[model samples]
Target: MGDGLRLALTTYSVNPRGGVVHTLELAEALQAAGVLVTVVALSDQGKGFFREVGVPVRLIDAPAPAPTLEERVFQSIATLTEYLGEIGDQFDIVHSQDCISARAAARIRDAGTSYRVIRTVHHVDDFTTQALMDCQRNAILEPDDVLVVSKLWQDLLLKDYGVHAGIVTNGIRAERFSAGISELRRKELRQKLGVDDRFVYLTVGGIEPRKGTAYLVEALARLKATHPNPPMLAIIGGHSFQDYRAYRESVLDSLEPSGLELGKDVVLLGTVSDAELPEWFSAADGFAFPSMKEGWGLVVLEAMAAGLPVVTSDIDVFHEFLTDEDDALMTNAGDAASLAQGLARLVDDEETRRRLAQHGPTVAARYPWSATAEQHLEVYRRALNAR
Candidate 1:
């Protein structure tokens, strides 16, 4: 405990999704606390996710590309496992953030004589494909100690696979996002994005079944009845390592409706740079997240930190950190009417919006990266000592 914990983190992608973001921040925080840290990921892209970052990303590029997700999954595991030869033996705690990395970590641990493997199940996916399902099962069960972002995910692990995962909730960079932008910066960002005096209802997750992209489109369309001058919906996300490009396009085909029109009212800004993300959050009037499922809705915390009034899905994972009326407005994910009403409440009521915004920064401030790193260290120490 005096010197440091030798921690090596493995994430599924060298991309800017919530899990990868968590891995980067946690590694840096631990490094600051005097721990020796290394990060590894399976790479499909040539560029690293961060521009100017402290921790160096070690990307294990696959030898040959695959046509489907199943093949990609196998290739990622094989590539990372083979590459693990160089870095796997140097750490006391080898933690994985996703399934592919978990499989790779297990392979490394089984082959090598050193290091303990722990898997952080960001969220449990009910995958239809057999290969993907087996990958998830092996990833969860093979690890020594499992970690999850929310109790809901932990409960899911227990019910479905009978594995109990430790709950180390996801953190937000509150100081990074919680700070208000200058009026000049705000005006510049608004003009640059071509978003006029419109009240922007922002959603950040890319199009997917779990993300409920279709449901939010319907809800935004339904909001037209109550909020006549409806907010233009801005979705800012890209496809992750998952092969969801086809899924995204299929969901987009369903977007043309009464109130929501693509290229006009509904703007799809596919993934903003990390440096510019806070500004995008600052420019928004409201944050809308109608996800069918979530581990802990990291974007919701980020929106709250930025002091935006939130209208998110009323899932159990969200309920873990956020209150019904106190943190943000919550709506049933399946019901478009309920979701519409939630967004309408935020749009119509100025006082309620102010209430959520004012209290949100305070809530976000409580879960900094330091706190998250501390929880991770506690678990790491327990694992090391037990070994």
Candidate 2:
């Protein structure tokens, strides 16, 4: 329980999703802060993380695709538990970033592992599956200490689960997004993506219910009907453990009725290379992410850091970091018309876009990875003292 403490950070995926990114970045930041941190994750097909990191990492091969989400959940837990049991007592802290990893850590602890379990509840999901619901609940209750990314989720944990979770807000590698991409490279990327003259609106975090994918399509349709020069919506990053095919198909089926074409109006670039992500952010005119729920919108901060005027939902977590009509344009959650109006304003009004874009990087600068690592160090010490 010192500055150079040994810590093992666990997450469910090696994908470039939010939580996994948090684990990797936090590991690197913690390592820089003199902590011996290693990130262990359940990799698909033994794949490594999307990007390189400075810290040591372990990628455990996850069980192959299961027939049901519940089956997959249990399989992942068993897989991680078995792996952790082999080296569970090697670290002073075993910090899990998601439900599956948390459950795995809990199981190892239940079997008398000496390492303390720390869980970060990114956000609570409303799962209908009984198994997942129970798993999520156990992930919350079983950890010796629970941490949340935002005060909104911290309050919810206290109110709903009677757990007083510590707050460790998310941080961004601002330079990664804000770093200058040459004009020539930007033009080349735009041409490669067929984003010639169209005003491009970018959104990351794939097509899922929580991301409000269908509503975004509906908004695009509405925008196309009246606007003389319709803009393109570029969707990126849709990797998920749960099945979203039914949801994706539903969105695609509604496209024709909504007067929107697949490749032309809405482009779904599912999982681009990490290098291309920042280029996409730079090649776009604006960022639209009308998500329904988030532990914290990490991408919103990224978009802001990239200096794009962002359009996100009017939710509590966003309210924590963004102000309406200021740094970002906030619309009503799940309301297509409101989202369309927000999108329209971002397109039509130059001053508003400029103002928002100007303030974005300043706002993003507040949450540095170094500061986040320091806060985590405090939490890690407190957990050790309590034990």
Candidate 3:
């Protein structure tokens, strides 16, 4: 993998979400490895984050006039053609992050261009009919090479959708997250959040049904009633879409009795910045994620890197990275009682939390961005060589 390879990655957005983080870290690692990489995003907000990280971002502008349905269709086609022409002479490969971007990249490659087309499928489970349709469409027009984040996703793509994809588990910057701040800093963060002297159980994700926020809240309520001193639950991240926003309000409404007031027992810190996440992770006694579905639970690795004990759903994707009673405590997904019990055991038992926190860093260290970048390099090379 020489520095001569020029690659362009296409994604929908560049927010600090899991997909955006994966794209940014991969691009940064590739650039560090001497590859000339350019990121192409649909939104300007996504481009801004990449630019801040020192990665070159080429954004496809929205339609000049207000876009009707027909105009939006035309705009997408026009942008794909324009981008293909603009970078055709400069890049060796073009990789798409999801179905929407893959559609455009596939069209460009079918136009007899020189650039090789690749696609990385981040999610496998199609919860809705529309989502299944999208996966089917992507399978129909699959690119030269397909990358999946986990073996479960790979199997799902092939067995269910007939799309052949290789596995490339997500990675994190272990060194950057390994910075162990003083216990005082952790204490101060908890104090600032009004959770001083209370066990903190942190859950980081958007307030969506698939994320199982309802289950987590129910588990918290259960813990409060069962335990003598229940841990304070800190739910970070914001609701981006309208459905989730409504669902979040409903969850909050249900939690009024458990002291849903802001900065109290149940705190919803909407969208914490990247800089502030480390302190919260360190301050928390345990990390709880009862998400029903996850393409790859990157937050689990992030929490482990920060040396926090994890209590997550017993999903296959999570099991690929963590083991029950070893790296994390696994609970039945969508089962509030199970989640609450799992969290209680970790919170009340200080020695158990300490064991998990101490051993988690060693497991997390194996998943650095450098290794992930090398795997992606091989995928790009294979895509370039494929007919």
Candidate 4:
């Protein structure tokens, strides 16, 4: 832990998206470990991060939203590159959490800055457009060192890109979520969300392609038919750099045919406050996350920390942390029928739910931000020595 070690951490946005959350948490943890960390992000219309940060922050003005994803990527890279160029020489390491930021870090490095560029590939995307594809490719290939959260992603990188990346899984603040909420506070949250007597299945990360929102809807529809009392599904936090209006429209259209109402049966509480997030987790009966892919499912760990029984996708990233019917009920990715069955089991089987809820905190306790920070320090030190 060098007191003189200064690092610049970059992310695409200041929103509560998984990557942004990772950047903020890591920056704070690193700062606590005696490293001078400055969190830099592309701000939309000059807005700051979702919550107050303990570490220093630099927000580059994005000013306005770009019409398309490709244009946004270009703008993010240009702005971050320009900003980093002005101050890049001051830091020993410039680490980026997303592709857009990674591209910018790569650009500044190409301009001959001595700062080491470290990129974390949370997950690979399947992009149809060549520009977006190339952006992803270059972001992965150009960085001095690439990191992934799980061995699943590390293996994927080696297989797909011929790149070997170090593995650093995510960590959680278990007690923040696991601490018992007062009954009054719990009632307040439930009342606020209009949840009364119904089992609430909560999923963060709003309607999007990767979140498997449509499939979750279909599962809810199926669960409604089989179960005596169908639980309400509450969705939270969908803010992202990419537009998902078309995907959102499709999810909305399916709601009518699935015999589900928008506000009552399925509540779309988009991007709730950071204070309210843990409260929502406390109020919900179960957590449902059927994402098709993730660098590592950070929310699943958060939900586990909150002592909520989880039903998530049987994806490789999840497999690294969860065991079927132990800490979480695993469902086949992209399969409505399988998800429905898994959800039904959680509803019907009290013993399994109790067991999962009991074990979840134990599982979540294994990952503390302190430990994650130590692992990252190792990576930073290695890169610095090599430099």
Candidate 5:
């Protein structure tokens, strides 16, 4: 392995979305660890965030004005080829996130450059037939080291797509998520949210179909019916429904007739700034995330780090980091009754919640960004050796 790796990280967009945040956090951590890192993005939304964190960012041409159906295919190939041809020689390793950048990185590797190509699969769905067609078509020609965030994703890549990938779980910055907030700040946050002394159930993620927000709402409704002192559920993060708008609308419509007060019982605060997020986690009594599909549930670790008990889905990926009836309470994904039961256990039993909260931070400490970056450094070395 070289003395210090010069890494070129590529992604479609550097927006403040979950995947973008993962890329930025990893890049910043790697740079702090003395690795020379350059972030290359197709869009500029997250450029400021990266620069503010002291990471060098390069934004490619303005995404070529959102292409139509016929133009989309040709434009994708052209844009990727153009970007790689222009900047492929500047680094020792090209680490790509998401499918588009993966294909681009593969193309650069195929060009016979000295730079080694590496790709990280943030989500298993990225390897689906319709999702990563370009990568599938060119993967054989453009061989590169693949990295996946979860064992579930790694297995999907190997079993479904026959692609070998190294596993590097996503991590959070523990210091930033620590429970050292002043009492004044906590009180201010609670006052701002109108959350008095009642227990709060918090879930943070985009409001999308895959995120299972509707399931969360149904569970909250169920909890209200059964429990005398039901905690309020606060959902953070905003999303575009687009074609899925009908489902979101239907869920809202159903909630209206369910006899549950919106602000009183359930509140959807949409997107929140990163600074405001920790206080939300700190104020919450327990965390509930019953997402049906996720590449990595980084929020679960964040909640745990904030000293909040977690109630999450019993999926293979989630189980890889959290155990059933241990650090987190696992419930059936997309099942409102199961989710409600899981939340009820945490709500009704204060001692159990306290016990889980006490143990949660210890488990979360194992997944700091430094460890995750070290793992990626190893992968970069392997890619460079292969080259």
Candidate 6:
């Protein structure tokens, strides 16, 4: 908040996942707050970040042929390790948005780079392999300061890692999503996607276990079996660091030859253009976020900004913001029938959808990027002053 309050943030990928999205938007907000900001990322994918903001982006080259998750993780650390090792002490704040960045920051310090890191543990995972577990643990232990998106995640860190992190919740670009709220654009997108008046449900997090794609597929099959002309579902976003090929095949293969036709009834819009994303959100009758795990459901706030009813998993983090039967309809994770019932309610009852949508924008309007920027500024000052 003063002179030379420079910030350098690192994220593992340039993919349009939640963490990367948070990094970009927060950078924009911090820049607007008169702070010098540089966004360092590991990919040049999606045309990079300059078009959206005026801040400089450091794109470290991570080439193709990433065959496995382990290889991908190592390559990310190696690339960032070199970059941060060389120039880690330049910024007043060196923050990481993902595991690999945390690892790199830790290694750079080990190599005698004098800098304290602020790591945002967006969410902690139940790592299956020892390698992944070490990645998460070492990242947490390395960071001098830690931040989490929700109180749920804060408690989780205390419970599991015996560590405490400050809470800084996510803020949506409500105006961006709301600006795309044109009835004309909505109908056009739906027609282009071949979705008719039949209730359309949209889920953006892609096909993965964390996103609860397997259970949602079962819900889709069940939803279609009961209704003659059932609703349509659009699955958006894909291809993150996780290798979900096996899980995708298992869940999707089970739904085939059933009433759920892949292209017609369900569309897998893998990685859509950013310009077209708001239009996609606008076209939805309801937003389905049935993830089994989350730090914060940032997209749910976005869907609310688009003025659509949301049907999300009734997880503790979700309860922090959303009120059941109010802002969003909640269902149990991994329960197909419960999810289907919520979906059916949104589709069959116009009043229910209208009611949820009515209250949604109000809840979404409370969290602004400016406020999030202020919170981050305070955290940055705390980290710097402590150093």
lDDT of 6 by residue, 224-281 (tens): 9998777888999885777788988887787686667788778889988888888888
lDDT values, one for every candidate: 0.83, 0.92, 0.77, 0.90, 0.76, 0.85
lDDT of 3 by residue, 83-134 (tens): 7666766778888776556777777777767787788877743434554466
Summarize candidate 4's per-residue lDDT along 194-286 as a digit string, tens digits. 877889999999898999999999999998877778988999988867788999998999998988898888998889998888988999999
The collision pairs in model 6 are none
TM-score of each: 0.95, 0.98, 0.90, 0.98, 0.89, 0.96
Worst 10 residues of 2 by lDDT: 189-198
Candidate 3 achieves a global lDDT of 0.77
| Pairs that clash in candidate 3 | 14-46
**Per-candidate clash tally:** 0, 0, 1, 1, 0, 0
Q: Residue 151 of model 4: what lDDT?
A: 96
lDDT for position 190 in model 1: 70
Question: Which has the better lDDT: candidate 1, or candidate 5?
Answer: 1
**Which runs in model 2 stand beyond 4 Å of their true positions?**
none
Using lDDT, give the best candidate's number.
Answer: 2
Residue pairs that clash (backbone atoms under 3 angstroms), model 1:
none
lDDT of 3 at 315: 81
Q: How do the residues 135-242 of candidate 5 rate in per-residue lDDT, one tens digit apiece?
A: 443542254777778888888878867888889978898777885578888788667667788778888875667778888888888888877777788888763211
- Which of the two candidates, 3 or 5, achieves a greater TM-score against the reference? 3
**Which residue pairs clash within candidate 2?**
none
Model 3 lDDT at residue 330: 95
Tens digits of per-residue lDDT for model 1, 196-300: 777888888778878888788788788765665876788888756667777787777777646557876788788788888888889889999989888788888
Q: Residue 106 of model 5: what lDDT? A: 71
